[model samples]
Target: MRRIVAALGASLLAACSTPPPPERGPAPAPAASPPAMAPAAPGALLQREAAVWRAARWDELPGWEADALQHAWPALLAGCARPAPGWEPSCASARALDSPDANRVRAWLQQRLQPWRVEAAAGRSDVRAEGLLTGYFEPQVQASRKRSAAYAVPLHTPPADLATRKPWYSRSEIERLPAAQAALRGREIAWLADPLELLMLQVQGSGRLRITEADGSVKTVRVAYAGSNDQPYRSVARWLVERGAFTLEQASWPAIRTWARANPAQVPELLASNPRYVFFREEPLPDPTIGPNGAQGVALTPGRSIAVDRRAVPYGTPVWIDSTEPQPWSPTPPPPRPLQRLVMAQDTGSAITGAPRADYFWGWGEGAEDFAGRMKQPLRMWVLWPLAHTPGDAKPISTR
Candidate 1:
């Protein structure tokens, strides 16, 4: 009996190990490999942008650009025909848009943009704040040589800006608009940035008042305003853990928010212990004026961060950003490259609060939020600040 049982077990194991036969129907095809793609880099982005700028301004290209388009347009167009995914190479192959036509397009774009001057005030170079350093904004072009007074103290405790939308209590008019809640939630976004970035937003109010005495007396104690800033989620959480707000493992958003709320006054102190960063986002960004792969407005899709060599960086330039960084978001697409290179720098947030810094534009949703929260790495890039210009005064590189 023992010998028979041992033999039965071996036979069963063998039966299980045998490969299953293919189905009677046609066999399934093997999984195909994704198309080959160039690894995304800032340099690649700059090259594409430089090419277009040179090509688009074919007439104005002074040096090598004019030569490339004249003699090498054919090969270049061929190389660009099979433009990689998310990259729109249509501009490159715009049906032989000879010099005159290309120059026309270039001229059209230049005319569309308006340059405004930031009138300086004759006040002291340094102004006093409640405690920390702060800034006052003047968005409009003034007539006289002075700053104007159309400011509001951002609801945010840290210094805040007018354009920087906040979840206004709306309690005042909440009953009127039912759709307001959804609209507010829709705009909620998150991003990751460096800790040490300085983001100082301010308002032009004399000071806030408090009811210290009873009856008819009130106190006019000055309130110091702080910029609305975020500690890269990672950095902020780490600080929280060190300060006994949470344990290393217990560090989490909900936990952090709760602790932060409980010690509202301590929130700034907690965040300041680490490097603080300001937020940046594109304004008038209903649609992007530029993108990674030369897409036009509204068509501005998401892209990864690319390091630019500031010397060549240009506003509204297209670029391909590698989309490979994995987090609590998507299962990480095979290394992201050249999805788009963001050219605008006036967005909100801390890490990106510098001129030289590029806030990689990760489109909407939770994945972007997760990416922004956990992000904290240096990137390499190919900058596309315009190389050839007729006479455009570009914004200076951030002096952070």
Candidate 2:
């Protein structure tokens, strides 16, 4: 019986191991490999360090047909004065343009330039087309040549030893230290009534001052960014939020001013939260219509000049922006009111980083201020390059 049981178990194991009958059908063909990407055309200027550069057509650009190209001519001319790499041909064509007609400018650009869409490189963790667009403008503020009962806040020029020092006196030190104050005693370019205005001027890096001289003669002049103390910048608004005094959403300039007015004793502490201080040099207003000098060392054109990351987009590069004027009251994003216009990358800011981020330069005065203060919008950008110019040996990979 034991022998029979063992034999039965062996038979069961053999049956379980037996293979099934094969199906009556032909085998499927081997999976094909994906098609290889096409190589870049000859003479393409590829920024290998950047995210990605994909060739694009003018027709593909949103609102291209509707943009007033003539309005950007002055800015184009200004950029030509300090042209970026491969911009010589385009700049020459721009310089030769005699007509200010929108159609003419549009035709000229269409003929000479190729638009390229900039996007995040493949395998990048953050891959997106949309970015943040903010606004900056030249502020027009009241000032005086000499400090008085009302105009107490002084705007100082950079000291001779500014370069020699690793980091100079901070906002609070300049106000409290006798030696620091002595270094800037005779270097007062102008004085303003509100300390916050002076702080804002420093933050903006440049502004137009409507001044009343000691002799009571009035004139408007520009105070351009001369130097800084080489210290890191700290935001007072962030400090306020960290201290639990106010939320981040309630840290607007007006809100801060209100807080300062209510707590006059803490004003100094509030101002001192920011360690960085900027110095300015007075400049003549050659063209009242044109804005102050930007980082590209040319006069910025209203609505056509932008500050971008130099690492991503070189200075003087033509950038097409697709953004909208922000609506502060709306909870939902407003319709894509296309600001799909040509703008020059002529400036940069500490806060303006990444490939797509930009700071649109709105000209001067209260209207500009209002626009700039309220402008933080979603944006997409395209860089326009000369079709005739291209990288010598490097092959560009098609992102599409």
Candidate 3:
């Protein structure tokens, strides 16, 4: 089965069967029809069911020429591996180039693709060109192959009767109920020393584990999202904020982890604040640099892969982002820098919807964690559609 790819980085969470709640940005006023004007030129108004794509010149994309297209080449090629409809010819041309030259890549893209400014379609509740941009990353945590006094927290596979149990068990009940425990008994894939890390794993839906086997051998592996207990997802960070543990603006993952450490006695209660429970399936991690496969069934390229609303932007399409880097987690951090760049629409999340919204993938490790944890910013997007295909030829109407 294809692996589940989901998340809304920082303090947000998503997974199969359980997606994070809709991300709410400023509620823009509904768009009004423009005053009578001359007919739009051919290829000007490219309309999809949920979005309006206005034909745009490449020059309109901020920082388009300045971007190092070579860095984005691999992600473009990766998306080509599972070419979306109308992307075959472009994919064929891309694979034939086989060169990583920045100039060549830039020229190829300019020659083969057209830019389209994305906006929420008229008649939508909130119609605007700007939208929310968040970030997500694969987490790396320590683990043990077998249960031990130190590594007592077990990350399990789906319960044997997960299917028949309807909503199965809440996170709290799974820990306290005998029936729930019995159903999950003997299903442990690995054990972690920290329950908060386990929660982190569950929230991200998938993560990397550096495991110590009984023989003292250490190796790394990936835990992919297998399934989830059917339950409503509540934000634990919000839970803390409501209880005055911290202000909502101070609810970064690092802050949460610090709170967990200082309040170890309440860790279980904190974990149970949200009722959702996620299950995992372990897989080999032969290459540490490559990321887990996204919903597109292709290994994601760090920094270049973005999770988008497939209803607005088709999978495999190249997107140009005009946003800023996340503000630092420090109290007196400097202002954010411009983060304009080229990215690919290779994945999706429950919370990621709308033409202009996106979730940037920051890869893995400590640095990635810091960046992704604070990456909620305003954004604008322009899709690079293949010149060979008209907007109508692309399938962004519905995934169903």
Task: Kindly give the stretch of ten consecutive residues in candidate 3 with the minimal lDDT sum.
Answer: 1-10
lDDT (Cα atoms) of all candidates against the true structure: 0.26, 0.68, 0.74
Score every model by TM-score: 0.30, 0.82, 0.85
Winner on TM-score (2 vs 3): 3
Model 3 Cα lDDT, one tens digit per residue, 329-353 = 5679788799999999877765566
Query: Which candidate achieves the best lDDT against the true structure?
Result: 3
> What RMSD value applies to candidate 3?
8.4
Q: Pull out the clashing pairs in model 3.
A: none
TM-score result, candidate 3: 0.85
lDDT for each residue of candidate 2 in 195-300, tens digit (9 for 90 to 100): 8887667766788899998899999898888788767666666676678766543344565678889888998998898777888888888678767777777778
Clashes of 3: 0
The residue pairs found clashing in candidate 2 are 43-390, 44-390, 44-391
Question: Which of the two, 1 or 2, has more lDDT?
Answer: 2
Off by over 4 Å in 3: 1-43, 121-126, 329-333, 391-400
Model 1 accuracy (lDDT, Cα): 0.26
Ranking by lDDT: 3, 2, 1
